[model samples]
Target chain A: MTSGDRGIRGVDSAADDFVARRRGQASAPAAADRPGWRPTRALSRAFVVIAVASALGVLLGRVDLVILALPFIIGTAVALRSRPTALPTVTLQLGTDVGAEGGDVHARMRVANPGEVPLSTAVLRAGVSPWVRLRQGHGTYAASVGAEMGNSIVVAGRAMRWGAHFFGPVLADTYACDNLFHYETLPAEAKRVRTYPVGEPFSADEAMPRASGLGGTHRSRRPGEGGELAGVRPYQPGDRLRRIDWRVSMRARELYVNHTLSDRDAEVVLLLDVGVDAGTSGGVDGKASVLDTAVRATAAIAEHYLHRGDRVSCLEFGPRVRRLRPGTGRRHYLSTLEWLLGVRVADGVSSDTRLLRSGALPPNALVVMLTPLLDDSSLSALAGLARAGRFLVAVDTLPEHVRPEHDGVWSAHAERLWRLDRENAIGELREHGVPVVRWGGAGSLDQVLRDVTRMSASGKAMI
Target chain B: MNDSRLAQRYHQGRAWLRRTQPGAMAVRTSVYVTGFLAVVTAAAPAIGAARAAGFALVLPILPTVRPMKVWPTALIVTCVAVWALTGEHSYALAFLLGALLYTHHTSAAQAVTMRTDTYVTPEVVTGWARRTGLVLLAAAAASALVGLLPRLFGRTDAIAYGLAGLAAVVGLGGVLAWLVFRKL
Candidate 1:
C-alpha cells in the first residue's frame, strides 16, 4: 500500500498497512470521490457568471451569436463545475547569513500532509526573487496524503541579497482550472516561510599568523619536539618503534631513538561578506546567497576544526552582524549549526565594521573570509580583520564564468565594467597582504589552494 | 464510513447521472420507444410521424442520449443524433450512438481509453481492476432483478417496463456505489 494513495502517511507506516491489508486485517475504502458535486471556489466560478449572463442575454434578445461562443460557453461551464481532491501542508525557512554569492545561501521549505483523508494530490512552489542560486534539492513532489506515509515535500532555493521575504498560505486545492488556478481544495494545515543571512567560506589564501593560541602548533616550532634523534638507552618496553634508531645501534649505541612531535590544530575564523552584491551570478547552487554560502562554510570549517581539535568561531554580517565565538567539540558544532541555520543577512544596507576592529578578532586568529568582494562593506570588513595581524585568507566566490545576460550592444561594455570592478577588489585585498584565492569554476582545487599560498606577500597579483 | 458503503453512494450518484449514461438510458429508451411505436402501430399506421417527432425532446435526454456511463457531454450529441435518426426509430443506430459515447469514456483495451497517466499509476491500475471486478459482480445481481421483475407483475409494454427495470438498476446501483465508497 503506497502511503500517499490513502496508502499510509509515513513510509514505515505504509509498510505496516500493506502487511495488515495482505493479512486481512487492514480495511480502507476502495472507492474514490467522483469528479462531480465537488466543492469549488468563488474565484474559479467567477467565469461561470459571465457564461450564465451570456446565456440569459441570448435568450432574452433571441441572438443567434451564442452558437459562435460555444467554446467559451462550454469552457467556462466546465470551469464552474466542482471537483474533489485532498490538500497538503507547506513550510519554508532560510539559513543564516555569512558570505558568498550575495546574501543568504538557500531557502529551505517543506510540505507535509497532516490529515485523515488521503489527499489524492498537492503541489507547492516558491516565489523566489532573482539573485541566489538553489544550493540544494529539487523542490517538487507529487503524492497522496495518508496516515501510513506523510504526504510531505521539501524545497530549497537561493536569494543573492537578503532583506526580507514572506511566504505562506498553503495552496491546498482539489478543484482546478486546468490545474492552474484552483477553486476547491481543502488545506492540510502547515504554511510557513522564513528568511536567513549569508555566511563565509574558509580560504587557504589568507595568511596564517606567526603564532596560534592552540599550543600544539606552537610546540611544533620548538626544537626539542621535531629534532633528529641523538641516541637511545637500552630498549624500554614502553618505547615506541617510531623512536628507534637502528643504524646508531649498529655503529656503537645499543638503541638510538628518533624524535617526533604531535600535529597541531589551526584556529580559523570565517569572516563572511553578506553584502548585497557577493557573486557575479546566482550564488548557492543558484538560490544560495553569499550569506548561505558563509553559513554552510562556517559550519564546514567549524566541523573541520572541531574534528582537528581546533578552536573555530564565526562572524556574520550583511545588513547587521552577529558572532559565534571560538569553541571546539560536538556540542559546539551543533550550537554552531543552530546559529548558522538561524541567521539571515542584516538589513542595515551598510556593513557593520565594528566587528572587524583589531581588538575584536582573537589574538593572532586565522581569519578566512568568503566573499565575491563586490563592495567595500564586505571587503573593508575582512581587510579590517586581516589588518589585526591574524592569518587572513579570502575565499573569492565571484563570477568565474563571465556570461552575458542581455543581447543589447551595451551588454559587452557592462561585462567589462563588471570584470574591472572585480579586478580592483582583488587588487585592494592584495594591498593588505591578505592571501586571496578566487575559485575558477572547474579548475584543479588543491593546486589552486597550493598556488595561492605559494605566492609571497610581495608577489600577490599574477592574475 | 466503509468501502462498500462508499461504493454504494458512488453507484447511486452515477446511476442518477446515468439518467444521462448511454447504455442504461439507451436500453430503457430502446425498449420503451420500441414498445411505444408498437402500440402506435397497433392503433394506427399514421401515428408514427407525430409520435417520433414528439419524442425528440426526450430522445436526447433519455437513455442518456448515448448511454448513462457516457456522461453529461454525450447528452447533446446523442440528442442530435437521435433526433436526426428518429425518422427511422432504428434501435441499431441508437445502440451505436450509445457505444460511441461509452467507448469515449471507457473501453475494453487499455489503448482505447482516456486518461493515461494520472489514472494508470501502478497502484491505481491494480485498484481499478479490483474495483471494476466488484462492480461487475454487483451488476450481476442487478441483471437478475431485471430478469425476474416481469414474472412478479402483470405484463406491460416491454419498452415502458424497461423504465422500471432501469430505475431498479440505477437505484440498486446507486446504493452499490455508496456501499463501495463507504465499505461493506
Candidate 2:
C-alpha cells in the first residue's frame, strides 16, 4: 500500500480507539466505594449543643435553656429521619472531541442522586483549560437535587486558540439532611478536546515547477496521455488510434496525431522554522505571533495543494525536527492539521540541521519554508538548499508590527538594526536564487512559483 | 524576618478575600450579623456580657481567619447562660431567644457548607429557608406544650419534677447515641 493509504488507515484506527476509550470511561463507576450518609461537622455541632443544653436546663431548672435546645432537637431529628444511603454520580460530557479555533464547545455536567433521599445541595467545581472561556465565569456551583433526579449544568464556551484543551476532573460533593450529612464523589477524568487552527483562504494559479505523479490537474512538459492538447504532429507508430486527428489528417493528406501534455501531481514540503517566536499571540481574534502566522499559513498552503491532488508534507525546523510524511486526499489534509497543533518552540535545545542532509526530502518537491527570518541558521539553511538546486520558496511569516521587548535605552535602535539585518539576509537568499516572499492570504507565492517553473522549464540550475 | 512572613501572609489573605464573590460574601455577612444580633438580644438584660459576646461574634465574620470552629454555637450558649444568670424569667424572651438561636444555627450551617467562591443557586437558599421555617414551627409548638404542662397538671414537687426532667434528658441522649452509632 502507498504511504497515503497507511496514513488514512492510521487516522481511522485512532478514531476507533477514541470511541472505545470513551465507552470504557462511561461504563466505569463514577466514584470510589465509601460509607454512606457520613455526618458533617455541622451535624456533630448540633448534636452536642442539643445534648449539653438539655442537660444544663434540667440541672439548673432553666426553662430558657431548655427552650434554646428545642430547635436543635427538632432540626436534627427531622434532618436525620430520611438519610441518603447512596452516593450521587457526577459525570462531565463534552459536546465533541474536536473543535475549530474561535468555535463554541458545549459541555454538560450531570450530578445525579440515585438514592431514595433528596440532596439539600451539591457543590461542583470543574477545572478548565485557559484556552477555553466558559460563559459561566466561575468554576464552582451549588444546586439542590431531588431524589432519583439529576442536575445538568450546561457550560458553553468559545475555543480561543488551537491546541488540545482539557475540560474537567470535576470535583463534586453532595450534602443531604439539610446540609448536616455530606458525601464526596470521586473526581472525574479530564476530557481532552482538540481545537484545529482555522486556515486562511489560499489559492495558487501558477503551475508547480515539477510534477511527478501520473494523474493530476497540472500539465507536465513530457508528451503523454492527458486532457490538455499541446499540438498536432505527424503520426508515430506507437501513437494510439484514438489520438489521431481526422481533420488534421485530411488537411495534411497524411495521418497526424494530437500531442497532449501529461497531467501530473507535485510534491509540496512545508518547512516551519520554530526556533523562536516573534510576537505575542492574542488568541484567534487577536494579533498573531510568528508561530501563529507560520502554522496558519502552512495550513492554508497545505489545503490548497492537497485539494489539487498534490502530495503534501510538513517538517518542523526546530530542536526536535518533527516530520509528517507526504500524503494526499481529505484524510491527509486532516492529518496535516493535527500535526500542526503540536508545533511549539523547544526551549534551551539547539536546532538540528541533520534532517536537511538526511536525503528524506524528495528531489523534485517544492520546499516552502515558513519562517520569521530572525535566525541566521535558518537563512544559511535556505541558502544551502538553493545552492543544492532545489526548488525553494521562503515565506516570511513575521508579523509586521512586532517589536523587540527590552528594558534597555537602546531597545529602539537595536530593533531597527535587527530589522535591517533581516532584510539584508533576505536579499542574500534571493541572490542565491531562493525566492523569498511575505506570507499573504492568497496569491502569496504565485509569482515566485511562476518564476521557478520558468527556470525549471529551461533546465537552469537554481544556484 | 517575622515582618516579611507577616507581609506574605497579609498578601495571601488579601488575595483570598478578593477571590470571594460579592453575593456570597453578602450572604455570609448576613448570617454572621444575624447570629451576633441573636446573641446580643438574648443577653441584652446583662449589658456587660452582651456587648462582649456581640463583639466576639464579629471575628467569625471575616470567614478566612475564624479562630474557632463552633463559634456560632458557642456564642448562642454564652448568651443563653447570661440570660439565665441575669435572673430573666420572662417566657416571651425565652421564646424569642429560642427562635433566634435556631435561625442562627441553621443559617450558619448552610453558609459554611459552601466555599466563599461558590455560586449558590436561589433554589438552595429557598430550600434551606423552607426547612428552617419548618424547624422553627416545630420548636415553637414544643415550647407551647412545655408551657401548658403547668396549667394541665398541678404544681409538682421540685425534686420530682427535676428527676423526671433528668430521665427525659437521659432518654433523648440514648436515642441520639443509637442514631449516630448505628450508621458508623
Candidate 3:
C-alpha cells in the first residue's frame, strides 16, 4: 500500500468525500497554508543550492565540493526537528445520540499553520488501533509547505457506536527533514473527545411504577391501600371486620368481610448487550454499535426508572460484566455513565451459566434484558432465567432486519448456521414466556415494555 | 491492574519499535554501526581490523544467512564502512561519508517482506522471525553493491557525495513512500 500507486483503500474514499463536500470550494487564508511549508521550501532551496554548488565546484575542478554544499545541508537539517505548536482543528460528526445501540461517528479535521513562516512540508498523523477501521482518509500525507496553504484532512472509519471512544496521541512530521539534521516538528498533546449517547424517551405518563414500592394504581397482594373488596378469611381474634368479605357472608348467610391491598413497586433492571458487532473499525457509523447505543440506552432506561422513583440497576455484560447495584438517584446515572464510558467489547458475549440459572435472580424484580442475539448461548441462559419467574422483558439488540451475507460456500454455511442459531434463540425465549422486543421500533425500551405488557398482561412471564 | 498499566506502557514502547519500519531502523543502525566501526579502527587498530574483517566476511553471506533479518542491516553498515576506509582521507570526512552512504535498500526490502508476512500471520510470536534467513542473502548482495560503488562511481573528490546523496534519496524515498501509503 505504498504511495507508488494512489490506490490506497481508505485514503481515496476519504479524499473523494471531502472534495465532493466542498465542491472544490476555496479555503480561507490559513497560517499553515501561507509560507508554513518550511520543509517543502527547504527541499526546494536545498536542491537549488546543491545544483548551484555542484555545477560551480565540479566545473571549476575545485576539491572543496563538500564545503560548498554545507549551507544547503544545514537548510535540510531543520527537517529532523519537531514543531513547537501546530493548529489542527478536529470536529467529530457522531450523528445523533449514542442510544441503546451505538450509531456512527465521523471525525473530520483541518490542519492549518497559522504562523507567518512557510511550511517546507509536514505530516499530521493520528494513531489508530485496529478497532476503529481506517475506512478512508490519509493517515499520513506528503505536502509541500509553501506560503499560505491549508490542507483539509480527514480520517473516516467505522468507529464503535458506544458513548465515547478515546483517540491516542497524534504526531505531525514534514518530509525530507526525516534526517535528524533537518526535521521541523511540533509538541504532542493529549486529546479527549466525547461522543454523546442517543436518548430514547419513553412515555412517562403511561408508566405507573409497579405498585410494589413505587406508586401504582393497581392493588397489591401485600398490605397497601386500594379501593377493592377482596376475599377475606375468618378473623382470628385479632382480625378486623374490614378484612371480611361481605359477599361471602351474603352467600353463606354469615358475617365475613373483604380485605384489600394495593399494587407494589416494580424494579427495572436494564441488561445491556455488549457485543463485537457494536464496534467499528474506524469511525462509529454503523448501527447499534455496542458502545454507541448500549450506553445511551442504559442511561435512558435508568432515567425512565429513576424519574418514577423505581429502583434501577444496570448490567453491562460483554467480555466484561459491569454492574451497578440498583438505586434511585442522580448519582446512579453518573455511575451508569462511568460504566458506559469504560464499556468495551473484550470478545463475544460471555456465557455465564449463573445468568441463565432459573430462580437465581432476586425476587419480585422485573427483568429488562437487552442483547444482540447473534448466539444461542445467551438466549438459552435468558430463557432459563425467564422460566424462573414471570415479569421477563427482553429487548432484542438486533437491527430491524439484518440478513448476513454469504459470499462463498464456507460463508454460506456460516450464514445458515447463524440463522439457525437465531431462530432457535428467539423460539426458546418465547417458549419460556419471556417477552422479546426487537430493536428498530420507536421508543425502543418503551415499545418492548408495552408490547410485552400487552401479550402477557394478565400473568407474569412464564418460566 | 497496575501491572497491566505497566504492561500497556511497555507494549507502547514495543509498538514504537514496530512502527519504525525495519528499513528505517536498518538505515539508522547502519549509520551507527559505520560510526562505531570507524571509531573502533581509529581508536583501537587491532580490534578495528579484526572487527572489520569479521564483518566483511559476514557481509557477503548476510543476504543468504540462515536468518536474513539482521543480515540486511549488517550488510548495509559494512558497505558504507568499506568505502570510507578504502582510500582514507581526513578522519572526520571519512566518518561522515561512511555514515551517510549506508545502503538502506536491503533493509527497505526486508521491511516490505515483514509487512507482507505480518498480513499473512499477524501474530508477533513468530512473524518477525519467520523469513529472517531469506533476508540474509539479499543483505549480503546489498553490502557487495555498496562496496562496488567506489569502483563504479569512481572515488573522485565528488564521488562520495554522489554515493551518499544516492543512498540518502533511496533511503528517504522508501520512508516517504511508507509514510504516504503506510506500508513499506
Query: Highest lDDT: which candidate?
Result: 2
lDDT of 3 by residue, A160-263 (tens): 43334433334444322222112323323323334444456643343432435645444455654556555565545765766666677888877664566655
In angstroms, give how far residue A153 of model 2 lies from its true place: 2.0
Query: Order of candidates by lDDT, top first?
Result: 2, 3, 1
Per-candidate local distance difference test: 0.42, 0.77, 0.45
Tens-place lDDT digits, model 2, residues B62-114: 43233125676676667666666777366667777777777777777777666
DockQ of all models, two decimals each: 0.03, 0.53, 0.02
* lDDT of model 3 at position A222: 68
Minimal lDDT window, size 10, model 3 chain A: A1-10
* Pairs with steric clashes in candidate 2: none
Tens digit of per-residue lDDT, candidate 2, span A1-463: 0010110112233434533443343322323555555677677778777877778788887666777788888888888777678878889999998998899988888899998889898877776666777766466778899999999778888888777777776767788989887777776666877888886899999999899877888888888889989999999898999999999999999999999999998999999988778677767888778878888899999999999999999998877678999999999999999998778765444343575675556888899999888877788878878877788899998888677776699988987898888888899888889899999989989999998888888764843
Worst 10 residues of 1 chain A by lDDT: A1-10
Q: Candidate 2 chain B: minimum summed lDDT over ten consecutive residues — where?
A: B59-68
Model 2 chain A lDDT-worst window of ten: A1-10
Model 1: DockQ against the native?
0.03
- Residue-level lDDT of model 1, residues A202-308, one tens digit each, is 33332233335534332333224434333356656777777777887678657766554434445667666655433232433443434444455556666655655
